[model samples]
Target chain A: MTTGVRRRMGVEERRQQLIGVALELFSRRSPDEVSIDEIASAAGISRPLVYHYFPGKLSLYEAALQRASDDLAARFVEPKEGPLGARLLRVMGRYFDFVDEHGPGFSALMRGGPAVGSSTTNALVDSVRQAAYVQILAHLDVTDPPARLDLVVRSWISLAESTALIWLDGRRIPREELQAQLVHDFAALAAVSAAYDEEMSALLRRILADEPADGPFADLVGQLIELAS
Target chain B: MTTGVRRRMGVEERRQQLIGVALELFSRRSPDEVSIDEIASAAGISRPLVYHYFPGKLSLYEAALQRASDDLAARFVEPKEGPLGARLLRVMGRYFDFVDEHGPGFSALMRGGPAVGSSTTNALVDSVRQAAYVQILAHLDVTDPPARLDLVVRSWISLAESTALIWLDGRRIPREELQAQLVHDFAALAAVSAAYDEEMSALLRRILADEPADGPFADLVGQLIELAS
Candidate 1:
């Protein structure tokens, strides 16, 4: 009789089980295509039980997306011990591995929905990613203020995401080759972007100290510094 | 009247008119919301005549997208003009101008499909963009092999598209501020990306010459080089 009744599971275990089932379903189909009934049937539970876990389809989808994101972040953001380049390569290796393993899930999360629809999830992902970038920035000795950090972080992530997506869309590239290219591509771009900032920041700081009045190039430099920050 | 009918309205002029009308409609409504009839009506033309000019809605959208792309490319890729840094700045400014002036259309294209059900349009935009990137690489004096050239072009385009979208989101800061950040950000990243390519390509060329059994990295790099071409 006890066995026939629902098995009592801790909240974390229950949530994990649901996420596992949800990930399997989402991988097989798109977020919009998979219904609550399918998730319940697959999970060996009643439909209402699935709803008890997640209130609606969007909620379920977001959970599944978060699971995938968490999985990737876990692999990608390890505090590996090495030189900056090697450490970055390690992080990127995990990143490439996750994408290679879960292409569809990654696409759905990164490319799906308007930004406003799931701002929370987006923020969560962005924060995890900012930590990863900061790790690399630390290696590079980039101690820019918060605003500058924001600019560089956002810029690099944008570069990395788009480059990865294009390669994923049957660009017919093998995983190892793509990963290598990504490493080189990202590392090289980071150097250039940092150099540009350093040059502009120096010029702008000089102008700000000496000239309060807006000269011809002062406004331009100020604007450029604003951007770098 | 007979002479006017026979005379060729410059292909460029006709193309401009079609793009202008399509951009107007796409700006106010989501791409799915706008239809051929509306575009024709807005342009003061018969529906059939619009069809004759554009073939279909996708073609019209592609034309509008292309026009925007051309405007942007013209602004950025000024060959025989200036250093890579200056050229890149001009290009970034043009992108900011584009978003400021045609916010919705730029948003739709950058946001990707469901705003416009036209992969063809996306591809057309990509091709024009790839060409522009190639021009920029040339201005930077990159003398890499064709395969390497492809990689440089692709990675650069990725940087531009990603930066533009991030700015358009209008979340982090004002548009004006974001635009300046973009210029500084890419200038740094692009220099790094280009520099890294030099190292990777040299490594790849040597490996290919050795013709040793390909490892995972070799295979992936080979596939990426192939795809880029």
Candidate 2:
């Protein structure tokens, strides 16, 4: 590692580097358990320099959290023209892969849920979740009141958060087995949120446009309303 | 408040008093934050007397936790015999009432989930959670394989735990409002658990026998499945 290369980095790069290092440490231990002094030492900068970017430890912690959320959001919000279902599956796949590689970071987030208010964390999680819902809503050609859309989106957020926690816990299920279940679950959840047969059928067309027409998930969600009825 | 009255108490009564006092403290603060001396002092007894029934602070914490779980399980397994829908609704009503009274204890249980795997707390939480599941299963007519039954029960547990946290965190959705939404969600989840319509219908029949027939949640499970399909 060259000092010249580190010195020449822009402010944005420095911020990202701090978050990256903080996430590494936070994954291994609670944020409180780690000190700003330690984070600064690990980042190879003076403690005051760390404070220059972040006002304090709490600010830094929230910033690192925001960085993680932004990283996740980038994967979820694709260009508006793709097949919704396939894009959704890709987002979920990316989610699982991210958690798989950052097991500690995932655990830290789950553990942080109660320490922070849902409103605090939801700002990050809700944005990524709503972006996915937008694709479905757009493809379904539906127009609804914003409040109702928000409720539906929050419900989907709850399901995805629950599913994410289950996967992150790394219990008995393998990643493949878990991802397969999520694909089915997310599709069913999406269909329910749309709440229009014509809309669903169109959404299904969009979903199947980019993938094989008859996965188990397609069959399962294909008859979701029937099973629900 | 007479000294004579206090001295006349039996060993069982004294132990119960100690537990009651310990629970009051434990509910307000984490286990580590409270101590044997404080508990004994709060109960108006000597420290050694507190240890006579519970060998140590951990045992006392476990005992208090077990009592809370037992109380919750008892409410869930009410003996009322009627339509499945009515019974289910009654149980849910009781469950929500329990939350209103004991939300802190329930929140503590959830926040303690990650701690269960730690050496200091695992056995108590695992056993109590298992006992709670047994109570839930006894109320259901599950014919799924044991593994599936375990997953179904865990799914319900997850829902209940998450719902309790949402409520405890002061979302303050009216009891009926929350229960109605839950009934819908659980019904859809129940339908998806089993394969055949007959089996699903039968399960719903048994469940509906425990709920009211004409309310918003009465046929919500079937309706949600239909909407999904």
- Candidate 1 is scored at a TM of 0.55
Q: Candidate 1 docking category?
A: incorrect
Considering every candidate listed, which one attains the maximal TM-score? 2
Candidate 1 residue runs with Cα over 4 Å from true position: A1-13, A113-117, A141-153, A193-229, B1-96, B100-152, B164-229
DockQ of each: 0.10, 0.10
For candidate 2, lDDT tens digit of each residue in A136-200? 56554556624323343445545555555655554544555445555555554444434333544
Query: Where does model 2 exceed 4 Å of error?
Result: A1-87, A99-222, B1-5, B8-12, B28-42, B46-59, B78-85, B112-120, B135-140, B143-150, B192-218, B221-229
Least accurate stretch of 10 residues (summed lDDT) in model 2 chain B? B113-122
What is the total number of backbone clashes in candidate 1? 14
In terms of DockQ, the best-performing candidate is 1
Residue A157 displacement (Å), model 1? 2.2
